[model samples]
Target chain A: MSASEIPVPQDPADALAAVVALRRLADQLEDAAVEQAMRAGWSWPQVAEALGVTRQAVHRKHAKRLIAAGVKLRRRSP
Target chain B: MSPIDAYLHTVIMEAATEARRQGSATIEAQHLLLAVAAQEGTAPQRVLASAGLDYQAVLAALDREFDHSLSAVGVSRAAFNLPRPSMPSKRPPDIGATGKLALERAFASAPRKKDLRPAHVLLGILQAEVGTVPRALALAGVDRADLLNRVRDAIAGDGVE
Candidate 1:
C-alpha cells in the first residue's frame, strides 16, 4: 500500500505498534544502505557526508557493526 | 548427480571460484547471489532475474555501489584502477559466516531433505537478517517482502525444476 493509503493509528496501542514497526524498518533500511555503501568501498567520512552526519558519529555507530559482520572496510587517506 | 550434490558442485563451486577470482579469502553472500544469477533454468536464478538482479545487472550494481562509496570519499574511478590479484586455488575457498548461515537457512527451509532447491536458498537469502544479499537487493530497489511472496507462490503453484 502507498504511504497515503496507510491509515493513521486511532488507538494508542496501534500507534505504539506502528512506532515499533517503523523503527524496526528504519533500522533495517539504514543497516542495508550502510552495508551497501561500505561494500561499494566508501570511506566512513564519505558515508557520513552522505548521511549528513559527522564522520565520527557515523563511524562510532557503524564501524564495529560492519567489522563484526565481515564487511571489508577500508580506511582511505582523508 | 543428486539434486543436492549437483547444486553443491555447480552453484557452491561457482561462488567459490568467483571469490577466488576476486582475491577474496572467503565466499560471501554476494558471490553466492552472483552464482545464482549466472545459472539458467533454476528457480532462484529466475526470481533474481525477474527482480532485475540478473548476472550483469548485479555485477554493475556491485561496481556502482563501490564506485559511489569511493566517490563519497573523494575518490573516482578515473583516479586509479586497483588490480585484483587472483588468489592461488590450492583448495576451494571456505564459505564465510554469512554464506554458511544462508546455506543452513536454505536447508532448514527445504520441505524434504532430498528436495532441497534453489528457491529455498533464494528464500533463505531474502530472509537473511544480516549479509550482503539483503543489502544488495535493497540497493537494487527490490521489495524483499514482495520477492518472498512471489517465491512462495512459485513454490506452491509449480514445483521447482
Candidate 2:
C-alpha cells in the first residue's frame, strides 16, 4: 500500500495524533480477542502463543481483567 | 520507520500478533490501547480492576470507539498482518519481576500466545492499582467505558470522544 493509502498524519502534530489513534484502535481489537480467547477455554500460554508475545508480558498485562471478570481460563484437556 | 513509526510498528505488530493468537478474527482499538498500557508498564489493567470497573462494559465502549475509527480506515480484525512465534525474544521482558510474572501468567493463561495482545496491557493497568487511582476513579464513578472512550479518543486524536 502506498503511504497515502494508510491513514497518516498530514502534519507532525497530526501524525502524532494519528499514531495515538491507531494505538487505541489496536488496543481495543487486542482486548476483544483476549476476552474471546479466555471465554473459549484458552490458557495464558495458549493466549500468549497465539498473541506471539511472551507469556509474562501477556499475564502482567491481562491477568487481572480475567480475574476481575471471573472468567476462568479453560485448562487444556490432558 | 520514523521514531514514531518504530514505536507504532512495534505496537501494531504486537497487536496483530495478539489478534492472531486470540483468534478473534480482527484487531481493534482496545488491543492497541492494551499495548500502550503494557508497552513500558503504564499500568492500566491494575488500575481498572482495583476500581471495580466492568470488563465487558469497558470492552463495549472500546468497540464503539473502534467502529468509529474503522469507518475511517476500513477493515475488520483479520485481513492484516500475522507473525508466527519463533524463539522467544532475546531482550528481557519489559515489566518488573512482579509485572513480568503477571505477563507470563497472562500468556500462560491464554489458549494461544496471540491472546496476550497490547490491549491486555491497558486493561492490566486498570486492574493493577487497586487503591489509589482505581479507587479514586471508582469513587468518582469512573468505569472502563470512560477509560475506553478516553483512550480511543486519545488514539484517534478526537480528544476523549
Candidate 3:
C-alpha cells in the first residue's frame, strides 16, 4: 500500500500501541524469513544483504538460534 | 534468600518462559502478569481468578489486544500465512522496560521490602494505565480500577495472616 493510503489510529495510545505491535510483528517475520532463507541454502552474506544489514551483524544475531534449530548453514560465500 | 525474593525469582523465570513461548525476546509486563496468573495458591493468582482472568483467559486477552493494536493500523495478522517461528532456546529472555517498571511499582506498593508479597506484583501490573495490560483488560470488559481495588484488598487480607 502507498504511504498516503496507510490508515492512522485516532487515539494516541492506539497509535503508539500499533507501533509496538508492528515492530514485534516485523521482528517475528524477520526471524521466520531468515530461517526459511537459510534453510533454503542462502548464505549469511546474502541474507544480511537482503535485510540491509552487515553479515557480521546478522550472523551475531541469528547464528546461534539457527544452529540450534539445526539449519544447515553455508559456512562461507562461494 | 528471603521468601519474597525467592518468589519473585520464580515468577520472573516463569515470565521468561512465557516470553519465549510467544517468540518474544524480552519478558514484558504482560508476561509477568501471565506468570502471576499461572502461579496457583497465591493471593495474586486467586485475585486474578476471581476477576475471570485465569492464565488461559489472560492469554486470550493478550492475543486479542495484539490483534486489536494491529488493526488500529489497518493491518491484519491473519493476512500473513507464515508458519509459527521456532523459539530460540539458547538463552532465556531478559526483562524488558515494562517488566522492570512493573516490578518497581510492585516493590513500591509495599512500604518496605520486608512487606513484599506476590499480590504486590499484581498491583504493580494493574497500576499501569497506558500499556498492553490495561488495554487488554479493558478490551476484555474488565474494570481496571475495580481489579486494582480487589488486588489491594487481597494484599491487605494477606497482611492479617
Candidate 4:
C-alpha cells in the first residue's frame, strides 16, 4: 500500500498495544493456517495461491519451523 | 503480569538508574537506549568500547544530545516533540519549581548563580563524576558528542520535527 494509504493513526501507546496484539494474532493465524494446509496435503504453491500470495513469499515467512514439533506458541487468552 | 510489559519495566528501571548514575541532568533517549544495551549485556558494549565510545564517551554524547535538543526545538525544551516510544523518561520528570529550587541548593557548592536552568543543573547530576549514564551510553556505542548530535537532529531535523 502507498504511504498515504495508511491512516494517520491512533494514540501511539494505544496503537502500540494494538499492533502487538495484532502481531500475536497474525502469528497464530499464519501458524494454524500453514499447519492445517500442510496436513491437508497441499504443496507450498497451492497454499500460497489460496492465500493470494507467491509461494516463495509464504515459504520465506514460515519455513523456519525450528521447533522439535511438540512446542507451539500460545494464543491470547480468550 | 503481561510478559512483555514486565520485560519492558526492567528495561526502564535500569535505564533510569543508569541515567542517575551518569549524573545526566535529564533522562534523554540516548540514556534509555544505553540502558537497554546495558541490560541486554549484549556484545554491543564490547564493540562500542573498542570504537572509543567508553562509558565516559557515551555520557558525554548524551549530554550534548540534551543541549542540542534544547535550542534545536523551534520553541524551547518545554516545546520539544519527543519520539513517542521515547517517553516515561528514565528519571522522574518532575521539572516543576520545587525541582528547580532543590537543584539550586544541590549546586550551592559550585561557583554559579543561585538559579540554574534545567540543562545547567541537570548536567550537574549526569556528569562523568556521578551517574552511570555515560557508561550506559558507551555500552550503546555512543558517546556524549554523538548523543548531542542525535538530540540536535531529532529536534531540528525535517519531517519528523
Candidate-wise lDDT, in order: 0.68, 0.48, 0.91, 0.43
**The candidate that achieves the highest lDDT relative to the unseen native structure:** 3
Q: Of the candidates shown, which would achieve the greatest DockQ relative to the real structure?
A: 3
B1-161: candidate 2 lDDT, tens digit per residue: 45434554676566555444433334434444344534553333434444443444444444444444444455454554433222222222333332343344434533454334434444344443332223334444676467754443333342212
Which portions of model 2 miss their true places by more than 4 Å?
A1-4, A75-78, B1-161
Angstrom error at residue B159, model 2 = 32
**In TM-score terms, which candidate is top?**
3
Superposed model 3: Cα runs more than 4 Å off: none
What TM-score fits each model? 0.60, 0.34, 0.97, 0.26
Q: Score residue A42 of candidate 4 by CA lDDT.
A: 69
Task: Give the TM-score of chain A in candidate 3.
Answer: 0.95
Q: RMSD for each model, in Å, please?
A: 12.3, 18.0, 1.2, 20.2
Q: What is the DockQ of each candidate?
A: 0.02, 0.05, 0.79, 0.01
Question: Per-residue lDDT tens digits of candidate 4, residues A1-78?
Answer: 676655433445334433433443344455566666555466777777888899778766555441223324232211
User: Which has the higher lDDT value, candidate number 1 or candidate number 4?
Assistant: 1
Ranking by TM-score: 3, 1, 2, 4
**TM-score for candidate 3:** 0.97
Question: Per-residue lDDT of B1-161 in model 4, one digit per residue for the tens?
Answer: 55334544554465556644543334444454454345333333433444565556556665554433222222133443332111112334323232334234335523444222222222332333212344344434545565443333332332221
Q: Predictions ranked by DockQ, top down? A: 3, 2, 1, 4
Better of 2 and 4 by lDDT: 2
